[model samples]
Target: MIKVTDALNRFLFENTPVRGNAVNLSNTFQLALNKQNLPLGLKRALGELMAASALLTATLKMNGSLVLQIQGKGILKLLVVECNSEFGVRATAKYKGEIRDDQTLFDLIEHGQFVITLDPKDGGQTYQGIVPIEGNSISAILENYMLRSEQIDTKIWLSCDGNSAAGMLLQKLPETMNQSTKTDDAIVHDLDAWNRIGHLADTITDEEMLNLPIETLLHRLFHEEDVRLFEASNTKFFCSCTRNSVANMLRMLGNEEISSILEEQGKIDVNCDFCNTHYSFDKIDAAQLMVSDVAAQSSKEIH
Candidate 1:
């Protein structure tokens, strides 16, 4: 039976020296797709991006969020999804032209750039990297990104349907050795093994990727090799938007702008593109928020 859960799993291999992760998002995907009418092709693409982002987020050893974004000049104009250490996910996509129901990544998007950003929650430094449209597939672009920018040996496999997305990542750990020995040779050997493993991973099929269970899939890919799998961390689709949050955003625009918007439209309407959640701010509500902000500032000054 198909297990219904949002999980992030980590694994390691023996003798060959590599680590891997498999992330599956079902509940999160359903939550993200709720109340939105998305074309099948677009839905698949978004699901793949969602799974990719969740897998990437799992690799983070620090407390932070990872944003995976794709921008193109073709029918698929933009797609963005983010996953945080807390397993919270949110996503949105925009497109143009004729969206075919059977369109693949290359069919919907001709030319695009993939960008990944790591933002730490603890106010640490953020890391951003950009990759050219290297391959026709999202996984290829991600592998290329790691090689060009991070200079790490990495592999990514992504699959998505309308209601679920799943992905796997395999990375070779940095070499460690004794300075008194021929350690450079060992490092090179490990690098060769990493490449070989990546080649094996390239043989994964779309059907197998999407349908097979995590344990079965790993064994199918690396049965002959020594592989260890870890427990799965759950993921969920969540949007950090609410009436209060929208109110605070209006406060940032200042009272004059809020007043002008209220005067013109009678109410300030803010719609979250990610979740399509709407928030309205009437003149009275805006005024109260402004007053509250002023009062808080005054109290701070008094202290």
Candidate 2:
């Protein structure tokens, strides 16, 4: 089994109109590191992205997926993670040269744009927001993006070492308490609840985030507040690439290009970047795939 202890929890102030989320990632970080031979710096960066992606996904009210990508011309060329509403996760990173031994975010990806793409699986158009890299930490950059692009008051705290990565998010949901609600009513009735909630999140330490279970961590953070915790969701390292997916790409390339590859390289070899799994098709296998492709095309025409 893929042992990923990443959990996402949605919480409400039970009596208040404010809502929040806290996400944890530990083994998930190790799983991503285990898949590729990444440098210490890149590994740390990837872990931050993993945790950030999870936190971002957990806040989605719509049934869709979010993809977090950072692209630049510096050492850390690319970092990407896709998280669906179901909490399924996968990631990939590309970089060149020695990731400075004691590198920070700026040291690695000099100038980049952090992008979040929302893909609704129910056949709707995807939306993307691009934000310039504004801060040294991934959390800061994301917080800035949320405020500047989405115009929502948001605060994020993310921390990661070589062994594990973790984060917390406090967002202002769209809701208003009934007019009868008053500050003298209860602890949750105050508008300052969002700031106070963020203060609690700030007290969370990296060790707690990396080791403690979600239940323990949440209780520790907001013990005094009336928190409504949702069922924890599971996250894992999953890649959607397969030999058949590669074959579909070959069909898209058309027969001439496919034949040219066979004539030159003897066989077509494809490797999935997400998992580093390789798929090779010999000339006969390639020809059979082509025949099936033509039949599918003919059937579509007949229909």
Candidate 3:
């Protein structure tokens, strides 16, 4: 039975230096795609990315958010998904021209770039990694990035069927020195174990990934090996956009820009691409923003 829904399950191979995560997004996936009018193929792609983002976020030890983006120069211009430490996920996509149902990843995104950014919730320096798009699917591209850029041997399998999105990730942990010494024999053993478990995981079919319960799936894959499954972490669709955030963004545009926009459009209208939430600012709101900014500046100067 598929007991896990909109949750991530972490597991470890007790005897080997390998760890893995599995994520299945149901209502969360549907809610994320509800606001967008994406093509079928692009919708599936975005769903896969959303699942992948959650899986990647689970691997991080930081207290912030992880953003995965694929920007292309072809029909599919941009695909972005963000997952926070709490497993809150949001996704958006932009595409120009027609995207056919039969088009594959390479066919839609022709000269693309994959970028990953880590934004800490607390005041800290953000880190980002950029690489040219590699591989044909989102799973393959991310696996390539994990191996080449992050220098971690990673394997990812992603599946999205418009309604639900699911993914599984297996990673080989770095060798640790036990008993004050590291030897070639230990390294060789770790390598052999890693390869063996990876091969077992490779046989999982997409149907199983999307349909099987976490316990059943893991047992089927690693029943022969000693594995320990951790408690599942809940995942949900969440958008962090608010009217105040939109106001702050407008404040950044300065008085002149805000005035110009207000004049041309009568009122400044901003719609969040992720959730399709609308925030409108009229002349009064714009004036209040400038007034608040001036008052804050005056207070700072006086101190």
Candidate 4:
């Protein structure tokens, strides 16, 4: 199989109690935006959020999706990013008022709760955590959440320049966290290694982070340590919307609501916000949908 150029990478310090993830998004980032016009600040925020979400998803052992959402009460009305186990990603943003290009990512948000949701693909139990907005940048907000809520010492750096997005994460684990067999001296060395590595990572400029390839970037940052790079996972821009999903959504609107819309408009037209795909349903389609739902419900009852 062909390798994925835009990918997620995992690396480990062989002798240190630290692990890291770096993601570079090029075509995927542009595809995710998909012609949705947004302000400069909001676009920057969305790009960083997408990169961060992809990195966090790689850290999990989940065959599902991780969603990052920010409900803003200011110029940036809202932002959402979702990354799945297979690395399929999609995002959307909303805003009002004027957003200056010079505004910081945090400046767009007056107040909001940061929410992280883990949704299993196989109908497994979902988990969600909401935290107060404590940090300014997307990187800072995620780092704060990991440290406070997940009890992990995580440092994240993310940058996006409309065309591409990149993010790097450094996580410090306790000696016992991984159940490693090491002497006290080794453990002490691990602690020191984390400090040194974090410092090195900090020295990486945004220009290098956004332009350098992941392998070159890793080698440059951790040349002193024995770094093990894992197989890269493919990533792409994908919107998980289909005609059936749209039908189910319409059913949830109830028959009375559907009739009102159909009677007034002659046909019901729906659009997917993430992908901008259009779907239209006429009266005949609506009737067929009702019949199909009844048949599906009856089959389930029989089973």
Model 3, residue 228: C-alpha shift (Å): 0.6
Deviating ranges (above 4 Å) for candidate 4: 1-5, 176-185, 291-303
TM-score of each: 0.85, 0.86, 0.92, 0.91
Q: List per-prediction Cα lDDT, in the order shown.
A: 0.80, 0.78, 0.88, 0.85
lDDT of 3: 0.88
Q: What is candidate 4's lDDT per residue for 167-277, written digit by digit as tens?
A: 889888876654334465676665577778989999998887788877788878888777888888888998999999999999888777888998999989998888889
| Top model number, TM-score | 3
Off by over 4 Å in 3: 177-190, 293-303
RMSD of 1: 4.0
- Give the Cα-based TM-score of candidate 1 against the true structure: 0.85
Off by more than 4 A, model 1: 1-4, 73-75, 96-98, 105-111, 177-192, 290-303
- Cα RMSDs, all models: 4.0, 3.9, 2.9, 3.0
TM-score of 3: 0.92
lDDT of 2 by residue, 95-203 (tens): 8877766877677777798899999989889999998999878888899999999888888877778777777787776555322233436634566877788888888
Shift in Å, residue 221, candidate 4: 1.7
lDDT of 1 at 248: 82
Choose 1 or 2, whichever is better by lDDT: 1
